[model samples]
Target: MRTKLATAVGAAALIVVGIGGAQQASAAPKAAPQAGLSGSKTWGNTVGWATCSGTGTFRVKAICKWEGDKHTSWVTLRGGSAKLVPPACRFKIERIGVHQSV
Candidate 1:
């Protein structure tokens, strides 16, 4: 009876340690992707394309129509003919259209 109780206690302790270790392992640091020249990134917050997009260190009103999340995030941009412009190499933002890529 004593041996059985000790074994059970030991097993429970090991299980606890194993679970803790697993959690810590998953908390390891991860590398972030490279950002483009227009580095106005807001993760969950949506901003006007002018607010986010860039045009030679300035924001263009006509180009500002392209509004959405950062390139790191997934967005659905579709409407009329998609007119896109590459403000940055990583992603090609639309210049004129119903939806913008950036």
Candidate 2:
């Protein structure tokens, strides 16, 4: 009777609320970007060595290519130089990218 009908209505309301909560979570904005390197490069030769130097509140990433292999290394620069020696297969620096923090 009335009690059963009320219980059913309460359950349906809870279900709707739950669905609304899930939708809000799914619609949430993406994460903000942090200080890091952004960009790319294409070296024509084996990039066995690479370095990054700068003066700022940013991060540097050196992308290197060795023979037919490629790798990436990262470094945070406050006001100096940062060097990156990729894995054993990397031979030269093909590209360098920087990202500054807000």
Candidate 1 residue spans exceeding 4 A from truth: 31-102
For model 2, what is the C-alpha lDDT against the true structure? 0.49
Q: Per-residue lDDT for 1-102 in model 1, tens only?
A: 999999999999999999998898466332111122132322112222322332222222222334431322222222222122223322333342112223
Worst 10 residues of 2 by lDDT: 30-39
Worst 10 residues of 1 by lDDT: 41-50
- Report the error of model 1 at residue 24, Å: 0.3
lDDT of all the models against the reference? 0.34, 0.49
Q: How do all models score by TM-score? A: 0.31, 0.32
The per-prediction tally of clashing pairs is: 0, 5
